[model samples]
Target chain A: MSFAHFSELLEHIRARRSPRRLAVVAADDPHALEAVLDAVRDGVVEPILIGDAAAIAILLRRLGERPDRFRIEDVADPTAAARRAVALVHVGEVDLLMKGRLETATLMHVVVDRSSRLRTARVMSHLAVLEIPTYHKLLAITDVALNLAPDVEQKHQITLNAVEALAAMGVVRPKVAVMAAAEELNPKHLDSLDAAELKRRSLAGDLPGCLVEGPISYDLAIDREAVTLKRYASPVAGDADLLVVPGLTAGNLLVKALMFSAGAKFAGLVLGAKVPVVMTSRSSTALDKQMSIVLAAAATRELVHG
Target chain B: MSFAHFSELLEHIRARRSPRRLAVVAADDPHALEAVLDAVRDGVVEPILIGDAAAIAILLRRLGERPDRFRIEDVADPTAAARRAVALVHVGEVDLLMKGRLETATLMHVVVDRSSRLRTARVMSHLAVLEIPTYHKLLAITDVALNLAPDVEQKHQITLNAVEALAAMGVVRPKVAVMAAAEELNPKHLDSLDAAELKRRSLAGDLPGCLVEGPISYDLAIDREAVTLKRYASPVAGDADLLVVPGLTAGNLLVKALMFSAGAKFAGLVLGAKVPVVMTSRSSTALDKQMSIVLAAAATRELVHG
Candidate 1:
């Protein structure tokens, strides 16, 4: 039941019985309000706006929407909004949390605080689901925005978080490609060694419900022609559902190249928390923000809440 | 005189009065021969094919070309062919070297050997000249194939190599972006630290003939909208001529994404040597291979030989 496109994910979410409750921290943000309005109009999410109530109302009115129709909390301070959103997650009031025009660090600190109740045993990581025009289906890339230089163990946890999140989204047995420079285990390259070790762990069933293959190059992972040409034998080759980049720099560069150069549409979410978090960048398009909200709503159904 | 596209580069080389002599190691490769034939027909290059003369002749005949029309050195073994190619470069017989049907390690070993006399004071690095549809002009990415995790000094050399090569090809004062996950100096991320150091060096005139900016992310480097959206201040921000990656993994991922997902046409060459070396990947299209030859030839005329 994997999604081939964002439209499919949107449709899948809309078909659900009821809209999920979403907490929009710093909800005074116009861009966030626009996306939330679209999601609400689509019957995908019921938003609990937590920010400067007066500002939110004004912005909502400016957009030709009635602010009185939605619930609004007057937490004017950005940190307070973030704290309130996390508090909602603690009391089973919100199924997901979203950052809105606030400093990401301000929201992230509250979300990952020891007392934030949104903390899960697994380390939180960012997952970006991209709709590349050239690809056959939706591809999920991980930790592009979060982990700086994740080691083997951190990457292991990151992989599990993505695999579980994708599974929750109806992707059965996601094929994961632990990306490296090339598809060979070179002693000189720690990335290749890390990839090989992850593969070994996958084989040991440490990373269950996923087929992990690596030290795979980008060409071998996505291009079947390259698989056939290089004669690289792996199930994950040419049909990767997930790409776990070696570090943040690689993943960030890859995603930007896809967006700016490849003309890809993407939706990003922060996983490994008690609830999924939507933190789209300011540069993200309206479509990207809408798709992210839809994706968050879709992934929210089976995930654990307070 | 910077090239806007690979066609412009081809035109630039074809406009030259005399064609540069190119030595193709293990020249029996069909793809290599096809590209060479195209370059020859375009009057851009005079190829000195060094490989098993029998196989080279057979391949030439198979491709509907005459073997007798071109000079073929009958070096039977791949290592011997690589050695002979390096020897030609030593005595100034050829202005450029192109790898054909041989292990890259074999050719690279010969080219980098102290006795081979191809080594320069600077570390040899691989540069990919990409003609992306979305970009305004050709973008050069460095060290995607050669250096693994280059230190700041090595990266300095790598950047110098790319800047010099682009300058030779008529790109004046190339704008270089030292890529990172974000455009901030973070103590935790060595990539960011390295980028800042490089920028500092560039400011001190250590990296002459280029505008080096860094601790910059991909979106800011290539997308003007992102630059405005983020309010990132840099001249190189929306119009980078070169991208120097933190390491091989990041660069390789970036280049592959541009190639496979972005539908970019690219040609690769090894720089910092006495002469530019064409070493296109097996998966490169014919245009890419031919463009590599053209690029090598254009770069060769201004580079040191003998």
Candidate 2:
């Protein structure tokens, strides 16, 4: 099944047989706690808050929740909290991992630690699902938060991570558009060359789960009118479920432009790990965090079943 | 004299004491002729159509214009028309060169030909002026249509070309934001390193006539709320007149996104030549082309007088 909106993702997660447990690292942040409380209330996820139990309870109570109503761990330090959360995931106690008030580097360091048992052979990549008002359906963009200047091989890995995550979310065959300045392959443009190679690899079944088209401009990738005007025909053209940007700068700008300028709503996760990791900015709204939790829940269900 | 809108640019050119003459190469395209006709009607420019006189007349007649209303040169071949336009500029017969039905490379080949008198000591770069609804004033993006992957030196030249063009358009000292993925400098991100060097050079007077800030993200560069939230203080922050993107891919995507997704109106020109060249896409609207002509007219006046 294909999701037309992020709300549908939330509804799908709500309809699951049981709520997936989330081990939230450094959960003392008010914004994160509020989202967790809402998800818990909506029967989306069961939360295991891994920060200072006293602080989490106070923040939860300030939102009019009873102190003892939710599970909480009294790890006062941020680093210790992250370690505990990772440990919970390692022992199969939690279905998902979340970053709360703690610094992403602090939590990610432990999560990727060899002894932590959370690291996978695959590279970790950030996958953002954007609900753009102008787009026909939710669009996924990858490596906007990580991978500064990914090479061709790393791009392959990044593409796989996003494709697999979307697959888990019921987009069985997502169309991926590897974007560049223009659709034509030019030797001077490394991005275009990489895109062409990626497209070739995708067609050869190197990337099995999605249809990939590349060396395409941003307008042709997402706008049907532009594709028609330019006479550029491809299955991914004008209907891309995922946009694999050339680099971090392009991806960062594209995602931020959609969110801050075009009024796009988004949820992001760090994939390619043992489990989906919900990592959002502290300034993000509670609704944004809740959507991320829902997305994570769905990915977790797929990981367990697939 | 920082104008807040493209209409101000149009009005500025219309108010000039004398209209600038434009030699439009391969001038049989309906879109290009329509825009040129509008500019002529507005008294912003005088046109010398240099393509097949018969085809030009037919298009003019279709647009309800008389065949004898404008000067027409019958160079039927695209290459010959481009050469003729370049020759007209070389001998100071026309104030600007405009591309009509010909491919961009066809015209640019003649414009940058070393044997051609239109070639200047400076490198040519595309300058786009975007009137985004959310922006406070016209935002100029550089090298969007030229210089695919400009190095640091080429970037410096591109930035200079845009700053000089904006200065000619009455912006005494244009504030340029050299864009990157993040505000902080990182060794891993070459754009950031280049941005830092450009900023240093701007401060050291290598890039004069502009206030430069860089290693800055798109949000903090244009959004005051983001600047305030991120605590990024700079004269160019939130009020940048020009955004020098890292390369062509980033710049092209940015300008196109502003146009197609953000409902922005735009005008573009090729600068750092003997004369400003109007080289808009054939698919561009009449208004877009007309604005580009106005911009080129303004730049021509500055080139002659400054």
TM per candidate comes to: 0.97, 0.96
Model 2 has an lDDT value of: 0.86
Return the TM-score for candidate 1, rounded to 2 decimals: 0.97
Tens-digit lDDT track for model 2 on B1-306?
787888888888778757888999999999999999999988888899999999999999999999897899999999999888888876767888899999888888888888777767788899998888877888888878888878999999999888877877788898898999888888888899999999999999999998999988888788898778777789999888888888888777777777777778889999988889999885687889999998888776534542
Worst 10 residues of 2 chain B by lDDT: B297-306
Against the true chain A, what TM-score does chain A of candidate 2 give?
0.96
Residue-wise lDDT of candidate 1 within A1-306, one digit each (tens)? 667789988887777757889999999989889999999999999999999999999999999998899999999999989998888887889998999979989999998889887888898999999999999989999989999889999999999989888887778899999999887789998889999999999999888989999999999999999899888899889999999998888999999999989999999999989899999888789899999998888776643553
Residue B61, model 1, lDDT: 99
With a 3 Å backbone cut-off (N, CA, C), the pairs that clash in candidate 2 are none
Show model 1 residue runs off by greater than 4 Å.
A302-306, B302-306
True contacts kept of each: 0.96, 0.49
